[model samples]
Target: MMKSLITTLLLITGISMAQPNHLPTSIPQTMSFQAMITDTLGNPITDGMHNFRFRIERPNPVQGGQVHVIWEETKQVAVVDGVISTVLGSVTPIGAMPFSNNFSLSVALGNEVISVSPLTSVPFAFNASRAMSANNATHADTAHFTHQAGHAHHADS
Candidate 1:
């Protein structure tokens, strides 16, 4: 029987403050994926290492507009108490995959295709990268500065 699926993909950007002078030049190319492996009867699978295949896809404009697979890889993940927590792109870098566009993910546990989820939101860090590219100005225009005079009056006055 097919296993029940509860899957999540969260893109996390870790800013290192320990080395404030050495900030990262680029956002990380990985995301955290978690799923609960359960049987059809809602029982957790036995805790152990399991093999899973993952694919990142987008809608293809060519070939009559089918889903296009951009990346795929197999990974061995450790499942504890029916929960599998793993970081995607650990084996291979998902470098510059253009998460700015619509994308979806598909997964297969062992030999069974388990779930497909839509990637509806892009991480805030990704948007920061877009802002950097959108700017063309080297200096601030219409800049202004002002100074105000200050006076103190006596309490009695």
Candidate 2:
């Protein structure tokens, strides 16, 4: 019993001397926010099906801080108030090169989607007030987005 007690005390003291309580040393990491949206049948969604039109001003890159990466199904997409949508944006958090299932991102547009025009699929209007006024509106096409990899980002208001 005395031998076991002494060994246990030594082990605890050793661990206390060696272990760290804080997060790992900070690195200038760039977080990538990526999403792979799929259909109900689990097929990859093409850019042709979406209109991306949202405006965002990214945070000034911090020294030694990981950059945030963002990706979404639409920069701008239709929103209807009374509608329940199954459309979800798949996400990958910052610094993850090969995206996995550790993160997911999702948002809703509005109330009722009476129609979606094939010609104009993008949902974000530069005119925020007017876009909100209209029960339904159009926005930037998803294919038009110039994604800068490794840039951290989120919605602008």
Candidate 1 CA-lDDT value: 0.72
Q: What TM-score does prediction 1 earn?
A: 0.65
Clashing residue pairs in all predictions, respectively, total: 0, 29
Could you give candidate 2's per-residue lDDT for residues 53-154 as a string of tens digits? 211112234745332334434434332332223323322213322222222233323332222211121255346335334432233233122132222234
Model 2, residue 71: C-alpha shift (Å): 12
* Model 2's TM-score against the true structure: 0.21
lDDT of model 2, residue 61: 49
Model 2, C-alpha of 108: deviation from truth (Å): 21
Clashing pairs in 1: none
The top-ranked prediction according to TM-score is 1
lDDT of each: 0.72, 0.36
The model with the greatest lDDT is 1
lDDT of 1 by residue, 33-114 (tens): 9989898799988899999999899998877878988888799999999999988899887777776678888988898988
